[model samples]
Target: MVTRQRLRRRNIGILALLLAGLVCFGVVEGVALPRQDQMEAQYNAAQNSPLTHDIARTSHYATRYMGNASKVTGLFRSLPLGPIRSFALDPDVFTVQVNLDASAPMAEIDRDRAYLYSATAAFAYIDNLEAVIFNEGSVAYRVTREGLLTWYGLDGFAALTADSAVWKTEVQDKLAEQDYARRAFQELFRESKTLSV
Candidate 1:
């Protein structure tokens, strides 16, 4: 009782369904998938910009010494009182006010907070100091010290406040080392730029 006309019509319907499924799949794979990939790439790039990362890393590493009050005290302990006082008064040497990014990671924020707190506490022993906080904790004064006793306890301020010239040489030597490190960092950054490009 089977008819050729009915069989042919049934086969034509099956072919039409298969054709529609193939078209839908092609649109999804060819158009939607590429668009999705492009959006993901853009999101990733925004999350991790190379320049921002490099700046943050450099600042964190370069300023790590500011977080250790004891170390800072030790470094300047042997310095002569006159040069120490002069350095403290020098606007170009001790004037520092850094505004950290609020969006930075918690670890980075904590490090910044520690540096500010330790530096401020250590420098509070200085006489005639004008340390001010303004703009909702966004600004502060330079770090320096002159007196013998701090709020925490006695630092190495006694020897530093005494007469000495050897410490000045040591300080200058340390600065030279830091300068070398900075130059090396710059060279590495330039190399990275070349590689990236």
Candidate 2:
């Protein structure tokens, strides 16, 4: 049988440990983490985001790269078919029509594929194009385009970290704003956790 005095001491020791733990957790989560998250957020707000800028710049460069593809691999006998067939961006919807000459040359199709793959890497390049021989006895291709900004924003979010309520709110706001961008990413991501072209 344990004495009352020893039982009291044991309770006091456990209480003391619990109090210390609470204090340490409070300091780390409430005090230290908030300040750090705020400082980082401030720094990010002031300077251009490396991720966004890089992605934007990449989008720009990729567009240019695709534009000049025909010169390197040779022009398709006709227009290039977009990969996207249809895109529904909530209030907005984009429908594409692609009618490229398939008989132009096999090499031309290969080059176009390279352009599509590269742009798709940076943006939402669709590939629903189908090779069809029209009633006129001619071959044609169709392509489509989709939201690209969403991918850019998601790629950016991967670099940010936070542990404060304020910073967490800020992150939420930024993500919300990204939804309104030309290419709605949140919806797309919600539909597919891991996006792929």
Candidate 3:
């Protein structure tokens, strides 16, 4: 019932589509997937390195002591806020300046989450750390060890940061919730909008 010419055209069109699909599959399998795998491998390597990213270092769990400023800097750098532009360690206070405008600009909730997680980690790992200050332009967020402890309760705080897995679940996972992060920030962090001259 079909003409020979019409049948030939349909077969050619089907072949063309098949060829295009094969090209796409080849590009993804040969190029895109391998690239993605390489990137993931690099990230995993970085994450596993203590010198680079030690925030998740389980070995530190047994000791629970970040003895010096250099070690503390490594911990802060490993945080999610990209990188620290500048860092200051004054006796017991740790302050860091970060570019809020870089890449993904942080919302208020995100800032709170970052501050809370950083503060909690700092207190947990740094033996001498009394407070952490995060500076973004004129605004600074300060979370004191005493304040955080009070917010979490002494026993609760100890339990929360006791282990890597527990810290991940209690602090990292819980911070993902905006409501909990909001309240936690309100209770733990003190915000100063204007830097005193």
Candidate 4:
């Protein structure tokens, strides 16, 4: 009777070992392996996107494109990282409320243009970050090719924190105060047709 029980116990132990091996293999092939492959494919796909290219180029342009001497100096000042405010205090992932003066004079327009560049530069400064602006509830027309191509969708106000991509609110309030979105970024990208630097 003792010998028979030993034989039975050995057989049960071998069965347990075999079952564990099959379970591990199933997890590897059915879940882990495929997930790894998918991540690699996504990385490869993202490398060549036009928006990625634009972002890279835009970053360079922001650094190089200085409108006027004073404007250039001023733009760098308002930058998210500038001497003004500690962006670190701002939500790491949040929307900004910019109030642009739509009725700005030619000088202000010039300044505004530089501000836009600085905004792009700000976006460039932060990695894995993004921003959007809305005037009275409509999207502007000055968005870059990359921005348009990569735009996912509208973000409800309640979801702002959840989105955490950082919105540049530099010109939104200014435009709303003036009640005109047409003059804000419209003439900047449309007429200037320039992406300096």
Candidate 5:
């Protein structure tokens, strides 16, 4: 009788432990796994965003010892805007003629973001770059290295070499927000000469 009682008790304890293990496995699979997947998706989307890509690309080039004017052309092409028709790189200023549809002009805010991001990337990569001008046929926006650095309130635009999280907070994420981008655009380009090309 005693032996039978002991065996029954041992079996019950083993069954309880197995049930507990199953519960833990269910929680991890049903709840934790989905949460982790959702977070991963959001991160991937942010990293793949156009703005993020531009920032990351510029950051990558900045790590190089020297950068050329071709990098600037590459930067403009990477923007969401239409293709570049032609570009003339002076000793200090780089002018880009972009092909845009007259019927469907880019939005003002979008133009600002594109120009600002491009200038930011240019100044970051090209060490001797002074200014960048984007000509949309009708008008042109000139962004100077001095003006952009001043607007960003940084003595040197070391944002390119900053840690990923810091760069995102200071540049990438801010440019993604319309209000912040507009404010930066106005601050950097307000005094710029917008001449008819």
Candidate 6:
């Protein structure tokens, strides 16, 4: 019973409404979803990355050593090889050097001394893993009597060899922790997205 013009108008109205809905959906998705996905991807990449973890840990230890003069010596002594562990994993990527002043304060001297011990222990640790310590200084310094004396004096080597099993266990534990953190972050991210919606 409708006139032709009326039917045409109704069809045009329906088409316009559909077009508006499509534009609204597109605008919301284009503005929001891509940005959210990008952010999540970046967060996941950083959180799950071993290099990132290593850099963070190295920075943390370095900051701790630099900030706390009272505890620096004891902490360094406790983790003699910790300074070089991150670098040891990729010799080709890193060039490490230790410059120590014999006339410095006891704390400074202890820190440098600890670093030297770490360098030595790192050499041994990498060598044990069948990787060559290509740094000439690393190779040459360890051959001298002073180096030998330092090696014999510290319990670093003994600890490294004796606690090899513990090191593996610790790595596994760290992986588990990372996994847990990643899951928690993912849950939080999902919650944030839901809240935003």
Best by TM-score: 3
Local accuracy of candidate 1 as per-residue lDDT tens digits, 1-197:
37988898999999999999999999999999999999888754532321111111112122223334343333333211111221222232332223323343234222333333333333433333333111112332232342213422455432432323422232212223444334422322111110010
Question: Of the candidates numbered 3 and 5, which has the greater TM-score value?
Answer: 3
Off by over 4 Å in 1: 50-197
Error of 4 at 45 (Å): 2.2
lDDT of 3 at 114: 72
Q: Estimate the TM-score of every prediction.
A: 0.27, 0.26, 0.62, 0.31, 0.60, 0.24
Instruction: Write down the lDDT that model 6 would get.
Output: 0.35
What's the distance in Å from true for residue 127, model 1? 34
Ranking 3 against 4 by TM-score, winner:
3
Given candidate 3, what's the lDDT at residue 45? 71
Query: Please, what are the lDDT tens digits per residue for candidate 3 over residues 1-197?
Result: 57988999999999999999999999999999999999888876755222233355533432234446567666676665544566655552344333343444577886777778767767776655676777776567777788888766664355765666776666677765789889988877777542231
lDDT of 6 by residue, 100-173 (tens): 23333234233333333343333333222211121222221222223433534543343433454543333223
Between prediction 1 and prediction 5, which has the larger lDDT? 5
Q: Which segments of candidate 5 are over 4 A away from where they belong?
A: 1-54, 59-67, 92-104, 190-197
List CA RMSD, all candidates. 20.5, 18.4, 10.1, 15.6, 6.9, 19.0
CA displacement after TM-score superposition, residue 87 of candidate 4 (Å): 28
Q: Least accurate stretch of 10 residues (summed lDDT) in model 2?
A: 128-137
Could you tell me the TM-score of candidate 2?
0.26
lDDT score for residue 108 of model 2 = 35
